[model samples]
Target: MKVLIPSFYLILFLLISNCSTNETVIEDVTEIESVYFPTVDGTNWETKSINSLNWNESQLQPLLDYLEEKNTKGFIVLHDGKIVIENYFNNHDIESNWYWASAGKTLTTAISGIAQHENLININNKVSDYLGTGWTSASIEKEQLITCENLLSMTTGLDDSIGDSVLPENLQYVTDAGERWAYHNVYVKMQDVITQASNQSWSNYFNTKLRDRIGMTGAWIPFSDLSVYWSNTRSMARFGLLMSANGKWETSQIIPENFINEATSTSQDINRAYGYLWWLNGKNTYHLPQSQLEFNGELIPNAPSDMFAALGKNDQKTYIVPSKKLVIVRMGEAADNSNFALSTFDNDLWEKINLLID
Candidate 1:
C-alpha cells in the first residue's frame, strides 16, 4: 500500500503539470493586446477604441481576425458613419486589387442610377430601345416591359438556364430575355445605353461625377479576373461608405435618396433576394415573394431580416444592416469548407466586438 501511494502521487503530479501547461485561462485570453481588424487596405489593422474594448485600429476578434490573417483578400468596416476597420493580407498592401465577383453588379446599379439622375434614360424604357431589335424574342409587350429597372431588380424573369452567358451583345448579350434569376451581366453591359444616352463612357461619367467628387483615388471602373480594370481595396471601401451614407459623398448628395432607396431595396422577380443587381434578406420588406428565390434555405443562415448584402463568389461580401447602422465588407477565399485555414479569425474578432458594445 505504501509503495502504491507514492506511485499514484507521482502520476497525479505529472497529470496536473501537463494540464497547467496546456490550459490557457480565459482572463489571460481576454487581455489580448490590441485587436487588428482586416480591411481592403491591404495591411494589418490600426487599432481604435470605442468604450470598454479596443477595436483593431481596424477590427479585432477571432473570426474576423482569422479571416483577415489567412486567405482574406481584404475587409472594411463602417460603423455609425466612419470607416473603423480596414485590413489586407499576404504582403498585399491596400494597393492589391481584388475581383468584386458578382458584387460588381452593385456598381452597375450605381451607374444606372446616375444615368437616371442625369435624365439620359428612364427605368421604364425597354432594353430593346437601347440594344435594338432581337435583344428579346418575347412578345412586343414583354419586350417593351424589359426596362432598365428589370435589369437592376433581376425581375425580367430571366432564369439561370438562359443565363447571362447566353444573353445577347457583341460576344455579350445572349438570346433569351425573360425567364429566371440568372446573372444579368448584360444589364450592366448596357452601360452602353447610359453612354449613348448621356454621351460618355461609363468610366468617364462615374469618375467625373462620383469618384473625383468624393475625393476617391482608387479605380472604380469595371474589372474582371481576366480584365485590366483592376480595383484596389480602398476604392471598394469608398463605395461601401457611399452606400452606407445613402449615396452621399462627403457632404454632397451625390446619390439621391429616392434612387438610393429604390436601388438598395428589393425587386419584383427574386425572393428574399434578387434586388436589381442587389440582394435582400427577404424577411419582411414587401419586395418579392420568399418562395421565388433560387436557394431553398434563407438568403443567409442567420442574417438579420433587415440585413442586405452585395455578395460575390468565393466569399466576397458587402453587408449592409441599416438597423445596426453598420456596413461590413469581407473579401476572402472560399470560406465555406476550409475551417483549418481561417475560421477562428472572424469568430474571435466578433467575440471582442460584443465586449466593446452592449
Candidate 2:
C-alpha cells in the first residue's frame, strides 16, 4: 500500500528548503565520527581526538574475527563520542543501509519530539484533533485523551508486540488510553499522528530534524530494499551519540529535555523499562548474564540511569550508557534472544576498559 504523504509533511520540507534558500544547499549526505568508550562506572569524563578510540579494538579480538569468519554483517562502537571500533563482515559499510527493524520505532518516536519542539505538534495534544477525517477512535476513551504521550509509552492498550511480525492500524484505539502494555503498530502508524499533527511526511520530519541535524545521514527505510532509509554501518553510531548527550548536539538542544526524559524514560507504569519506543536495562526483562556475561549487572530505573538503548530485531542496537559517558552500537543477525550477538561483546568491551580506566 502506498502511503499518502501528508501536506503538512510537505510544508515541513519546504520550510527546511526555505531555510537553505538564501545561501545554503540542502543535501542528503552521511558522516562517521570516531568515538571513545572508556569504563570506570563513573560519569566524569573528557574528550581527546585521536586516529582511533584505541581501547579494546581487539579485546574480543577472537570474537570479532570469528564473526567476520562467518561473514556476519555489521558492527561499530562509539566510546566517549569517538569511534573506537568498526568493521563489516559480509554486507556492511558507511553507506550500507539496513533496517532498524523495531529500532525504527525509537527513531520515529524521536522525530515526534522534534515535531513538538518545532510547534508542528504537541505531545500532550490529542490525536483526533490533528488527524481530521481519516482518523478513527473506537475506544470509549475520549479521543481528546489520546495524546501523543499515550502512544509513546506503549500504554495505548492495543495489541502491538515486537515479537509479532505485523500489526494493524486499529491498535491505536482498542481500549482506554492507558489500560494495558501491548506494543502496538499504532505507534508506527501514528506517523499519521505525526503527519496529521505536524503536517509533515515522516521522512521529511526525520531528514529535517534527526538525519539532517545530527548528521545521521542514514535512510529511514521501513520497506523497499534501500528504501526504508539508507546509511552506512557507522551512521548508526551517531544516533547513540544523540541519546547519550540527552538530545544536545555539539551544544544545541536538538530535542527538549522533557522529550528525552519521556522518550528514554519508561512512560508507562506497566513497563518500567520502556520509554517512548526505546528499551531500558533497568526494567526486569533486561537482566544481564555473567562470567562470559561478566557485566556490572546494573539497571537504570530512573533518570541518570547508566544504560538506555534503542534495540531491534536481529539484534540491532544503539546503546547509551550515561554513567560511563559511553555510546555503543551493534548491527547484526539475531543470534539468540537471550543475549543478542553484542551481549558478550558489550560485557567484554566494558570489562576490558574497566581494567584500564577504572
Candidate 3:
C-alpha cells in the first residue's frame, strides 16, 4: 500500500511539473506577441515611462544634448509600439513637418509589396511591363533585363552620377542590370509603376493603401523630379511601430509578413547591407551611396547586429531592431557636413543610445 501511494504522488508531481512548463512557454509567447497600436484618427498614442522599463535615466539628458548639438530636430524611441522617448530640439516642435529625404524609399518598398500581393504588380516583371518602353536610355534589351526587383535593390545599373532625376536622358545605362549596386533615385520609378498599375496617382494610392491605414499623416511633395515624403515626428514613429510589429497593425496585415522578411533581409549579393530600399546593419560587408567601395564590417558597428534602418540625406533615420523590439526615429538637418544616407553621426549617435538603453 505504501509503495503504491508513493508512485501515485510521483506521477502527480511529474504532471504538475509538465503543466508548469507549458504555462511558462505560453507566457513567453504572449509577451513576444504583445504590442500596442495607436489610434488611427486620434492623438492617443500610448507611452511607457523610462522608470517602467528600468532604463538608465541618467544617460537620457546626454543623449538629448548630443542630438541637439548635432542639429537633430526630432527624435523618438519606441519599445514594443509604446513611446519610450520623445524629444525635439533646434527650435523644432512635435507639430513641425520634416522631409524624409531618401528614407521615404522604404515607404515605396512597402507600397510595392502591397501592389504585388494584390496582383496589381509583380517584382519579377520588367519595369517596361507597367511603364512601357523607352523609360531609360538603355537599349530595349538592357532595359528589359531590369526588373522591378532591380529597382528595389538599387541594382538598376543606371548611371547614378547623372544626378537624382529619373528622366530617361539622365538614366543612362552603366552596366547590365544586377551587375552593381548604386544608390540612385531610379527607385522612384517603382512609385510610378505603382501609379501605372493601380490607375491612381502616387499620393492617392499611398494614402489609401498605407498612410491612411496606419494612421500616418504625410504627403509626397515634389522636389524637381523627386517626390519626397514629409510628416511630423509622431507620424514617423507610428510607421516605425507598424514595422516593428512585422508589418501589422492590430489584426490587419498591412504589409505581408513574408514580404517584410524579404525586404528586411539582404536583397542582393552586390550590397550586403541593403534590403529592399532599406539599409541593413550586421552585414559582413556593405556599399554606400554614390560610391562603389565596399566597406568591411557592419553598417553601424555600435547598433544591434539585427538592426535595419531607413537612412536618408541630411541624417533622417528610422532604425528598427527586431531582437530588441525597438523602433528609433530621427529627423532634421545634416548632423555634420551634409551627407547622403549614412555618416559618422550614426556610429556616434548609437554610442549615446547604448548608454541609455543598455
TM-score of each: 0.69, 0.69, 0.92
User: By summed lDDT, which 10 consecutive residues of candidate 1 come out lowest?
Assistant: 27-36
- Could you tell me the TM-score of candidate 2? 0.69
Residue 347 lDDT in candidate 1: 38
Question: lDDT by residue for model 2 over 1-358, one digit each (tens)?
Answer: 3344567885686687777746544343444353433222223224443234344334456656655653347776556676555667775665677766666677777778888888887777776667643343354354456667777776654444333332333434545777666655566645766766656676776787777776665666545221244465656777777777777776578878788887877676665656787777755543221111222433433323457777665566677777766766666665444342234444443444344333
Largest TM-score belongs to which candidate? Answer: 3
lDDT of 1 at 258: 86
lDDT over C-alpha atoms for residue 68 of model 2: 66
Candidate 1 lDDT over 1-358, as tens digits, reads: 1222356776686678678857632222123232222333334324333432343324345545566545777877666545566677765677677767666667777877777887878877887777775665455655665777767765565443443343342222223344444454455645666777877877788778776665455554434312123466666666776787788754567877688888766565434455667776634422222223354544553555666677665556777777766677776676655331112333344344544343
lDDT of 2: 0.60
The most accurate candidate by lDDT is 3
Which digits, one per residue and each the tens of the lDDT, describe model 3 over residues 1-358? 1223356786686678787845422121122248989899957988899998888999999999999999999999998888899999988998899999989999999999999999999999999999999999999999999999999999999899987789999999999999999999999999999999999999999999999998888788989998899999988888888888888999999999999999999999989999999999999999998899989999999999999999989999999999888999999999998888999999999999999988
lDDT, candidates in the order shown: 0.59, 0.60, 0.91
